[model samples]
Target: MARQHPEEPTLVELTIEEVKAMGKQGIDHPSTRPVITGGVVGAIAGAVLPVVTWPVGLFAGAAIALYTRVKR
Candidate 1:
Protein backbone atom coordinates (compact mmCIF):
# COMPACT_ATOMS: atom_id res chain seq x y z
CA MET A 1 0.00 0.00 0.00
CA ALA A 2 1.10 3.56 -0.61
CA ARG A 3 1.70 6.06 2.15
CA GLN A 4 -1.46 7.42 3.78
CA HIS A 5 -1.50 11.20 3.66
CA PRO A 6 -1.16 13.57 6.58
CA GLU A 7 -4.41 14.96 5.25
CA GLU A 8 -7.66 12.97 5.07
CA PRO A 9 -8.59 10.83 2.07
CA THR A 10 -9.64 12.78 -0.95
CA LEU A 11 -12.48 10.70 -2.44
CA VAL A 12 -11.53 7.24 -1.27
CA GLU A 13 -10.18 5.78 2.02
CA LEU A 14 -13.19 6.84 4.01
CA THR A 15 -12.97 5.15 7.43
CA ILE A 16 -15.73 2.89 8.74
CA GLU A 17 -16.49 5.23 11.61
CA GLU A 18 -16.63 8.13 9.19
CA VAL A 19 -18.85 6.12 6.86
CA LYS A 20 -21.22 5.08 9.65
CA ALA A 21 -21.36 8.62 10.97
CA MET A 22 -21.97 9.89 7.47
CA GLY A 23 -24.63 7.23 6.98
CA LYS A 24 -26.63 8.17 10.04
CA GLN A 25 -25.61 11.78 10.33
CA GLY A 26 -28.26 14.27 11.46
CA ILE A 27 -30.83 11.48 11.63
CA ASP A 28 -32.60 9.79 14.54
CA HIS A 29 -30.89 6.49 15.28
CA PRO A 30 -31.70 3.17 16.94
CA SER A 31 -33.94 2.73 13.94
CA THR A 32 -36.12 -0.35 13.96
CA ARG A 33 -34.95 -1.28 10.47
CA PRO A 34 -31.65 -0.18 9.02
CA VAL A 35 -31.96 2.31 6.21
CA ILE A 36 -29.96 0.24 3.75
CA THR A 37 -31.76 -3.01 4.50
CA GLY A 38 -35.09 -1.26 4.44
CA GLY A 39 -34.26 0.34 1.14
CA VAL A 40 -33.22 -2.95 -0.44
CA VAL A 41 -36.31 -4.69 0.85
CA GLY A 42 -38.51 -1.92 -0.43
CA ALA A 43 -36.88 -2.03 -3.82
CA ILE A 44 -37.32 -5.77 -4.13
CA ALA A 45 -40.84 -5.66 -2.81
CA GLY A 46 -41.87 -2.90 -5.17
CA ALA A 47 -40.32 -4.59 -8.17
CA VAL A 48 -41.67 -8.09 -7.56
CA LEU A 49 -45.03 -7.37 -6.01
CA PRO A 50 -46.61 -6.24 -9.24
CA VAL A 51 -45.90 -9.45 -11.17
CA VAL A 52 -46.85 -12.05 -8.58
CA THR A 53 -49.45 -10.76 -6.19
CA TRP A 54 -49.57 -13.83 -4.03
CA PRO A 55 -50.85 -13.55 -0.49
CA VAL A 56 -47.61 -14.96 0.93
CA GLY A 57 -44.91 -14.03 -1.50
CA LEU A 58 -42.01 -11.65 -1.99
CA PHE A 59 -43.65 -8.45 -0.84
CA ALA A 60 -45.20 -10.03 2.20
CA GLY A 61 -41.95 -11.79 3.00
CA ALA A 62 -40.03 -8.56 3.08
CA ALA A 63 -42.78 -6.78 4.99
CA ILE A 64 -42.95 -9.51 7.62
CA ALA A 65 -39.22 -9.59 8.08
CA LEU A 66 -39.14 -5.85 8.52
CA TYR A 67 -42.23 -5.53 10.68
CA THR A 68 -42.61 -8.70 12.75
CA ARG A 69 -41.47 -8.74 16.39
CA VAL A 70 -41.16 -11.67 18.71
CA LYS A 71 -42.66 -11.40 22.17
CA ARG A 72 -40.51 -12.22 25.17
Candidate 2:
Protein backbone atom coordinates (compact mmCIF):
# COMPACT_ATOMS: atom_id res chain seq x y z
CA MET A 1 0.00 0.00 0.00
CA ALA A 2 1.16 3.53 -0.82
CA ARG A 3 1.65 5.97 2.02
CA GLN A 4 -0.18 9.31 1.99
CA HIS A 5 1.57 12.61 2.84
CA PRO A 6 -0.16 15.35 4.78
CA GLU A 7 -0.64 18.71 3.08
CA GLU A 8 1.12 21.74 4.54
CA PRO A 9 -0.85 24.75 5.72
CA THR A 10 -0.58 27.95 3.69
CA LEU A 11 0.55 31.19 5.32
CA VAL A 12 -1.44 34.35 4.71
CA GLU A 13 0.27 37.73 4.87
CA LEU A 14 -1.25 40.78 6.54
CA THR A 15 -2.36 43.78 4.44
CA ILE A 16 0.42 46.00 5.83
CA GLU A 17 3.04 43.35 5.08
CA GLU A 18 1.76 43.00 1.53
CA VAL A 19 1.91 46.76 1.07
CA LYS A 20 5.44 46.91 2.46
CA ALA A 21 6.53 44.14 0.09
CA MET A 22 5.02 45.98 -2.87
CA GLY A 23 6.67 49.21 -1.76
CA LYS A 24 10.03 47.45 -1.68
CA GLN A 25 9.43 46.19 -5.22
CA GLY A 26 8.68 49.75 -6.38
CA ILE A 27 7.82 50.34 -10.06
CA ASP A 28 8.91 46.81 -11.02
CA HIS A 29 6.03 45.36 -8.97
CA PRO A 30 2.98 43.66 -10.57
CA SER A 31 0.81 46.62 -9.55
CA THR A 32 2.61 48.84 -12.09
CA ARG A 33 0.20 48.01 -14.92
CA PRO A 34 -2.93 49.19 -13.14
CA VAL A 35 -1.19 52.35 -11.95
CA ILE A 36 0.08 53.16 -15.41
CA THR A 37 -3.31 52.45 -16.94
CA GLY A 38 -4.95 54.72 -14.41
CA GLY A 39 -2.42 57.47 -15.16
CA VAL A 40 -3.08 57.21 -18.88
CA VAL A 41 -6.85 57.27 -18.37
CA GLY A 42 -6.52 60.25 -16.07
CA ALA A 43 -4.30 62.09 -18.50
CA ILE A 44 -6.82 61.53 -21.28
CA ALA A 45 -9.62 62.76 -19.09
CA GLY A 46 -7.62 65.79 -18.07
CA ALA A 47 -6.97 66.59 -21.69
CA VAL A 48 -10.67 66.34 -22.41
CA LEU A 49 -11.55 68.54 -19.46
CA PRO A 50 -9.93 71.97 -19.37
CA VAL A 51 -10.17 72.40 -15.59
CA VAL A 52 -7.61 69.75 -14.57
CA THR A 53 -3.99 69.55 -15.66
CA TRP A 54 -2.52 66.36 -17.11
CA PRO A 55 0.10 66.02 -14.36
CA VAL A 56 -2.42 66.49 -11.55
CA GLY A 57 -4.79 64.04 -13.13
CA LEU A 58 -2.00 61.53 -13.64
CA PHE A 59 -0.94 61.69 -9.96
CA ALA A 60 -4.52 61.44 -8.71
CA GLY A 61 -5.25 58.46 -10.95
CA ALA A 62 -2.08 56.63 -9.95
CA ALA A 63 -2.74 57.28 -6.23
CA ILE A 64 -6.30 55.97 -6.56
CA ALA A 65 -5.18 52.87 -8.44
CA LEU A 66 -2.44 52.14 -5.92
CA TYR A 67 -4.90 52.59 -3.05
CA THR A 68 -7.34 50.12 -4.61
CA ARG A 69 -4.57 47.59 -5.29
CA VAL A 70 -3.18 47.83 -1.76
CA LYS A 71 -6.66 47.57 -0.22
CA ARG A 72 -7.24 44.33 -2.10
Candidate 3:
Protein backbone atom coordinates (compact mmCIF):
# COMPACT_ATOMS: atom_id res chain seq x y z
CA MET A 1 0.00 0.00 0.00
CA ALA A 2 1.21 3.49 -0.84
CA ARG A 3 1.13 6.25 1.72
CA GLN A 4 -0.50 9.59 0.92
CA HIS A 5 1.46 12.50 2.33
CA PRO A 6 -0.95 14.68 4.26
CA GLU A 7 1.30 17.72 4.07
CA GLU A 8 1.66 17.59 0.30
CA PRO A 9 -0.56 19.58 -2.04
CA THR A 10 -2.34 17.70 -4.79
CA LEU A 11 -1.21 17.99 -8.43
CA VAL A 12 -4.26 20.05 -9.36
CA GLU A 13 -3.58 22.59 -6.63
CA LEU A 14 0.03 22.97 -7.69
CA THR A 15 -0.98 23.40 -11.31
CA ILE A 16 -3.50 26.10 -10.38
CA GLU A 17 -0.91 27.98 -8.36
CA GLU A 18 1.61 27.72 -11.21
CA VAL A 19 -0.89 29.16 -13.68
CA LYS A 20 -1.75 32.03 -11.34
CA ALA A 21 1.93 32.79 -10.82
CA MET A 22 2.54 32.83 -14.55
CA GLY A 23 -0.27 35.36 -15.01
CA LYS A 24 1.20 37.55 -12.28
CA GLN A 25 4.63 37.35 -13.90
CA GLY A 26 3.18 38.33 -17.24
CA ILE A 27 1.38 41.30 -15.70
CA ASP A 28 4.54 42.39 -13.89
CA HIS A 29 6.77 42.19 -16.97
CA PRO A 30 8.66 45.37 -17.88
CA SER A 31 7.87 45.45 -21.59
CA THR A 32 4.09 45.47 -21.19
CA ARG A 33 3.91 47.45 -17.96
CA PRO A 34 0.35 46.14 -17.83
CA VAL A 35 -1.17 48.97 -15.80
CA ILE A 36 0.23 51.92 -17.76
CA THR A 37 1.04 50.63 -21.24
CA GLY A 38 -1.25 47.66 -21.77
CA GLY A 39 -4.24 49.23 -20.10
CA VAL A 40 -3.86 52.57 -21.85
CA VAL A 41 -3.30 50.98 -25.25
CA GLY A 42 -6.25 48.67 -24.80
CA ALA A 43 -8.51 51.47 -23.64
CA ILE A 44 -7.58 53.75 -26.49
CA ALA A 45 -8.00 51.03 -29.09
CA GLY A 46 -11.30 50.03 -27.57
CA ALA A 47 -12.57 53.59 -27.61
CA VAL A 48 -11.51 54.29 -31.18
CA LEU A 49 -12.44 51.03 -32.85
CA PRO A 50 -15.86 50.75 -31.28
CA VAL A 51 -17.20 53.39 -33.65
CA VAL A 52 -17.31 50.75 -36.38
CA THR A 53 -18.70 47.89 -34.33
CA TRP A 54 -19.10 47.52 -30.57
CA PRO A 55 -17.65 44.06 -30.24
CA VAL A 56 -14.78 44.82 -32.60
CA GLY A 57 -13.23 47.31 -30.21
CA LEU A 58 -13.61 44.93 -27.31
CA PHE A 59 -11.86 42.22 -29.30
CA ALA A 60 -9.12 44.62 -30.31
CA GLY A 61 -8.58 45.59 -26.69
CA ALA A 62 -8.32 41.96 -25.71
CA ALA A 63 -5.82 41.33 -28.48
CA ILE A 64 -3.76 44.32 -27.43
CA ALA A 65 -3.68 43.08 -23.88
CA LEU A 66 -2.55 39.63 -25.04
CA TYR A 67 0.08 41.11 -27.33
CA THR A 68 1.41 43.29 -24.56
CA ARG A 69 1.81 40.32 -22.28
CA VAL A 70 3.48 38.21 -24.98
CA LYS A 71 5.64 40.94 -26.45
CA ARG A 72 9.38 41.09 -25.75
Tens-place lDDT per residue, model 3, 1-72, is 999867877555654554466578775654334434445555666667645453555556554554545442
Q: Which candidate is the best by lDDT?
A: 2
Model 2 stretches with alpha carbons more than 4 Å out: 1-28
Model 3 misses residue 71 by how many Å?
A: 0.6
Every model: Cα RMSD to truth: 12.1, 7.7, 7.7
TM-score for each of the candidates: 0.27, 0.61, 0.32
Per-residue lDDT of candidate 2, residues 3-42 (tens digit):
9998643223344554576689977878877888988888
Cα lDDT for residue 30, model 1? 34
Q: Which ranges of candidate 1 are over 4 A from the true structure?
A: 1-33, 51-72
Of candidates 2 and 1, the better by TM-score: 2
Per-residue lDDT over 32-65 for candidate 1, one digit per residue giving the tens place of the 0 to 100 score? 3444355456566666777644433544554444
Greater-lDDT candidate between 1 and 3 = 3
Q: What overall lDDT, based on C-alpha atoms, would model 2 receive against the true structure?
A: 0.74
lDDT of 2 at 46: 79
